[model samples]
Target: MKRIESEQNASIKQWKKLYTRKERDKLGQYIIEGPHLIEEAMNHNVQIAHLIIEESYQMPHDWEQLRLDPWVVSKKIMGILSDTEHPQGVLAICRMSSKELQVKAGGKYLLVDGVQDPGNLGTIIRTADAAGLDGIVLGEGTVDVYNSKVLRSTQGSLFHLPVVKGNLQDWIAACRQEQVPVFVSALKGAESLHDVQSSGTFALVVGNEGSGVRMEIMESADQLVYIPMFGNAESLNVAVAAGIMLYELQKNRK
Candidate 1:
């Protein structure tokens, strides 16, 4: 296997480029740092461009033989490329696959509207994947999915779901094209989340943690739903809200 000891190596520069959204978009590639995420990506047959491993990580006795032929690199180089202070020593660059955004009429989907935090975005994606939602629609102003922290938080769920992204109005137009009902979540006066009655497919819109859904989108929603909070706190985290809502939506799905 090749070794990337020099920080100045061309490949190192390319691997480092995965840190920025522009570079990730330009190349359609993302970096996974933790060993578990890397293994999941490999096992799922995601397209891996390259992998970097630190010699000090000491190959596992059982895994050394079957894992991909990884390039060994110095710890300093890992520090330079990894976003985390404590680098996982094993990082892999993988390509992003295309996802379908449009849903069939009355189909199920989760719309992440204007979410900005990478960690929240990642957790939401992981939760949505686990809930068996058809896919995720990341509306405008959402965090970059390829952000190192977000990708790490997803724990490789990014590979499992169909994640489509666009502006609020544009996604709404696309949903209309598919005849899917849009359910927006709001803090006040909205019906309880479980009260919504739907015919076929539906898209749940969970907005930013601070602002909630935009006024325009809320107006367009077929129905607005609110989660009842028993505690003094106003509401739940976006990811937590997503989990509750998804469970409510798919409680009886086969």
Candidate 2:
């Protein structure tokens, strides 16, 4: 294991740059902090480029057996790398998967559009995984899935399934070719979510917090469905609405 004592270390400088989306994309890697998320990455066989630990922290016994060859860094260096106010003493730089996912018949997916909040995007990913969807499609204008807050918000669920970034229109076109139904959530002129019949194989589209789904995409949906509101609340948070719709759709899956 390497011991890195200086914040000026070349590797540490590069790792710190990962905090930016542009740098992360350029490097094709992202940092995940906390023991739980790192463990999930290992369990899921996600390629971990570096396992970093603060000098004072003790690694778990099981982890030591894996021979990860972690870099031991001073507390100061860890603090510089950590995104959280309270550093967890451990984190990793993981390689991004290069696999491309396709939208096909007989599979269920969640399509996100223009969700700018990292927490919302992460929660949507977590909810989709919990609901047992095949995968998630992050449409253009969605927040980067590798954002630190997004990674933390997912609570390790991101490792459980494929989350692909792609063009929504292309994905929707593919879904149509596969004879899969596409349901877009909207406010006006949309059927109540309870009134729509899910065919077990469909794509559920959720959109921006302020503008809702784009009119062009909504118009392309096979059905536009909205959750019935009994209370005075005008709308649901995108993540909450997604959770409700995902479970409801999954409940009737064949």
Measured by lDDT, the strongest candidate is: 2
Please report the TM-score between candidate 2 and the true structure: 0.97
- Native-referenced Cα lDDT, model 2: 0.91
lDDT of each: 0.82, 0.91
Clashing pairs in 2: none
For residues 153-234, write the lDDT of model 1, one tens digit per residue: 8988987878877777777777878887787889876998667666546788999989989898898887888888778988
What's the true lDDT of residue 40 in model 1? Answer: 79
Q: What TM-score goes with each of the models?
A: 0.89, 0.97
Best candidate per TM-score, number?
2
Candidate 2 per-residue lDDT over residues 10-39, each given as its tens digit: 999999999999999999999999999999
